[model samples]
Target: MKDSTQGTSPGPGTPLPDSILIVGGGVFGLSTALALAARHSGKITLVESSPTIPNPHGSSIDTSRIVRADYAKAAYATLAESALEKWRNTDWGREGRYTQSGLVLVSSGDQFGKDYVRESYENVKAINPDAVEALPTRRDVERAAPGYGSGLHVSGGYVNWGSGWADAEASVAFARKKVEETGRVNFRTGDVKRVISEDTGSAAAAARRKVTGVELADNTIITADLVILATGAWTGRLVDLRGRAEATGQALAYIRISDEEQAKLANMPTVLNLSTGMFIIPPRNNLLKIARHAYGYRNPQRVPSPADSGSNPTQTRETTIEVSLPEKDVPIPQEGEDACRVALKEMLPAFADRPFVKTRVCWYTDTPKGDFIITHHPQYNGLFLATGGSGHGFKFLPVLGDKVVDAIQGRLVPELQKLWAWPESPPAAAPPPPSSSSPDTVVWTEDGSRSGPKGMILMDELAKGGWKRSSSKL
Candidate 1:
């Protein structure tokens, strides 16, 4: 975390090691591969757990994800604006992949919610004055998007026509095709058992571990000069990110709407309520989606302590640690369904009683400040991390790789270098790490954009099942 921000062009790759292995084929992984293949001549291999490029279980493979430059943080807002340009001007946004349906961010009068909406208005207005409108009351919000029920639980908000949503699956497929055209990257499929490492010194005595490669679940080993761990939510299985990052499940439900209903709401702006952590995008293809963007549920599982990550490790070798991993291809639990159902009642009274045709528990790799971890391990050489999407990484799909490559080569801009670097100390928003050897801690993100229930366990909620339907589709 040196002063890499000064005197560096945040440009393309700089010919990394002769062999580079990127783990996971999701947003961060595929995008990184596409960028690397374009700039580097060395051998580059991309490995994925799923045979297909758009893994159905991945968080990035959803129907739609918000793409907005309306962020309270100026840095992310500016970066998102740059990405919006690509989604608007380049082929990256073609073929129904990107839709500028606009977005209205409303809040329920809480201090944090109000402050977040207010600052986001200021930032996005500065970025695009033509499409910005400030709604200072609930009536004003209803006026901005008449499709939304007039009885919304918001005090004030703003609408940014500059923002939009992206087709997550299509964009990932597009990225994969782009990488394949390069013909410089080798693709492999395997579930990584663990990252293999070698250390000159003992586990103690301040030893530095070098990751040679990864060992697959079938015991197949692949060696490389550099290994980029962009495994998204599953990164904790290969690295000890107890306090820094972990997987949290967010709830979403899709309902069937008639053609007439779809036409009426299809082009309406997306509405997100910060206080309740709920939102709804316009219906498409006779399907409407509602989701909660809150502090999500954690599904804790016992896993072997991952690599040291050059960070200090107190645990002895060959030990098991319980961390939150993804419960893929599973339906969201009763509590989440209830939350979404209640929000539907408030936001769209017409669809409040309709049964959800599908429900999903999308997982997010959350960090304390919602900042992505995209730098070399502070303690391990040849081990780089590009994860911690925290539910907002999809919009950056167009340009995430270029920035990642820049950071890899130490040419990233000064501002981004500071934001993406490995934390020297525990973040203020991060829960305090467990004092004992037990790695039991809750990661409550206080980035001011999240709300709703906290500390709900995934299994516990599923056990108390009360779905409108007997079985829910994945």
Candidate 2:
């Protein structure tokens, strides 16, 4: 019953609270808030600037593709294995959840494309040797889909039964529904200006300078014992807590397909074009979603409010839905679409004339490396950093939430550390933890001391941005 929305410090040995505040309400944010709600019971509250789950300018809600367990990294494989099960089991009956449509990799023979085939094939083979196989020739691929007979070129790489898609928007709605019923969370429509931390000193200050609460853009202040800033693309907007703003931008698109073509390719599975750096996903209600593998697009740092989308009720949902092609200055590129059309035509050529129906965009928050950044701020003891998802975070949202929970609890997560640690930039040459003499515990300085690792070499790789942490309130 503490004003769970407002901040108040714990005095002396007085027990600190279990109540928490969750910011943002997107898929990851909602899922994290709901998972933490289930984990901590009625001890969480969610603050959202939008009235609903899918922010119009946000990522598409219709996608159902999940990369599954064929990931190259051991951590990713294990996490995907668990997430696949959760998606299958309905994880407590959340609708528009996971469906195993499997994933297909297509290539016309470029270095990156070949690399994708090799990597995906290697990963799949290591796990289930029989899961991946190469198609013999273009004729064989054409046999798989009537359309591919002429237009599609086949390098023939694919992972069967491992990858799939999910209803992203529905997933968000489901998670929100689950957490909404908890009665501990109240979804208020207000923008978060900053996450204010309490001031505390010394080791005993564990209960001291932790996140006190958040301030809304309206000037109304809300506080809590703990705060989780899960806002997506706008994550850095929360606070400048010791260099946590490190956010990047990314974008995604959806291609329009004919109703008949959509149905034909509906079962076509998620296909990655290694050569073109494009991916085609079969989404809900019959649509093919296309996106690029790289990031660094023209998406701005801040998304406009609902009003900016001309999203007024009279404006209509169709009016709010918008799309932008890969190159900002150029006209929407038809080359990617042409590639997809040709490939799909080869696979099932019934509709070469069918043009891309619609398009939309979304962002990815990236770290210096493509890995996630989930840790505590060294200087700001109370705040935990959970941004930097790059592009691959969606498939691992649940596990990521669990890791965030571990960080909030202040316990070292061994498995998580491998993925989250900035090994190259060990925490600034500050005094070592009390017990450990050697600073073997790697840390990254905001000044770029710990940017990457040995295996994770830098390639001037595109920095795509992506969001959310969790809470403990009802």
Candidate 3:
């Protein structure tokens, strides 16, 4: 990992606090820590619940994540554009951590008129005309991808040649290493229990709530002038976000293929089928990944059982934690599996019969709307938030830290200040469950009634059966 701080130093004006503590070691936490360490003459300490920077169960911990500028909204498109530039020129770029295989956006409806795909293409083209190639007809798509002509409908979309993917886990590790080498960052292993605040009395309380530091689960308090909560899915568990965000568990699966098969499918760009919310990433180490990008299932908040009393029980009789215990594992829901089958059959028929090599449920800290929450706590003076990835944040790995720095320094433009502020009202609740008769149309629900898709089984169960592929065709 290259030291991004070598050529840069903090500006003479507006020096940040001398000591900062950042919780969570995922993309947001590591990136922000690196950014601050480069510019501020401060001591930065990053804490991770897990022993590693890129926790195995982290949402950002995966073989690959799509890095594209094809977003319906211009803000994300602009951010992605800047991030891509850095990815291609930075140390990670030089190390082959980012693969520039391009991305293909697919839509089911007529691609000519106004729609998500059309808007995305227009946005990217406006940013860089030569960055995308419009595939206006099926022939054009077929020429680009031969096997996609079967069940996939490529009405009107473009290939973002400037976009690609990043080795997610590797990127995290590399950034951590670079930050540590600077001799300014201290990385520690600990689970943050809650943010610590001090009362400023009734009169001063109206001014600003004073945040002291944070308390760890092991009963240790690490005090700092400023504390940033970058804990992705677990953000809600620590702070009273007022329904601004929730932890959602999305489905992801990997399919194994032979080297020959990998070579044959090497040219297939990362496919994001907007209609079905299914995305198929290109092969990495002979494994193709498929994931769902729609409204994922909410983890059930758990309450401690009252029947048992032990000195070191996992859960206390009065205490409760959210679902997805650190050791708990979940499988791909039937809905996700069906979506992948439908997508592969239509877009990449060659992978329809490939055996599933691995399956796991990845969690995302989703906001009511897609925008991120990177603002200071309205009530806590020394507390800030760098969360709300919304499942699409990893793509901004290169430039996101800079924005976080801007937020911390009170230099954000009016537009961004308003965009990243806490929501005025709580987001609407999840939609009602679909009729049981319409199994395919039903979405995941918070209640156990629709815990998972019909006939959903754990990966452990499938592993016992050798994880075989079904012979039936889509």
Which number leads on TM-score? 1
For model 2, state the Cα shift of residue 426 in Å.
11
Off by over 4 Å in 2: 1-17, 91-96, 107-110, 134-150, 201-210, 239-259, 299-355, 397-399, 410-413, 422-474
Regions more than 4 Å wrong, model 1: 1-15, 201-206, 307-316, 425-440, 466-474
Q: What is the C-alpha RMSD of each candidate to the true structure, in Å?
A: 4.0, 13.1, 7.8
The prediction achieving the highest lDDT against the true structure is 1
Clash count for each candidate, listed in order shown: 3, 40, 2
Q: Which tens-of-lDDT digit does each residue in 1-474 have in candidate 3? A: 112211223444345887999999888998898889888887789999989777877888888898887877666777788788889887866676898888877665643222777888888888878768898865666665563555666565678888999889888888888788888888889888777776557676644566778888899999999999898877766664435666666778889888997887766778776655677777778888888776665544443421121111123245543332222355665656777777777777878887777877787676656678898876667888998887888988777888888888876655566767876556555444452221221223221111223322233334455543242111
TM-score of each: 0.92, 0.70, 0.83
Which has the higher TM-score value, candidate number 1 or candidate number 2? 1
Consecutive 10-residue window with the lowest summed lDDT within model 1: 430-439
Candidates arranged by lDDT, highest first:
1, 3, 2
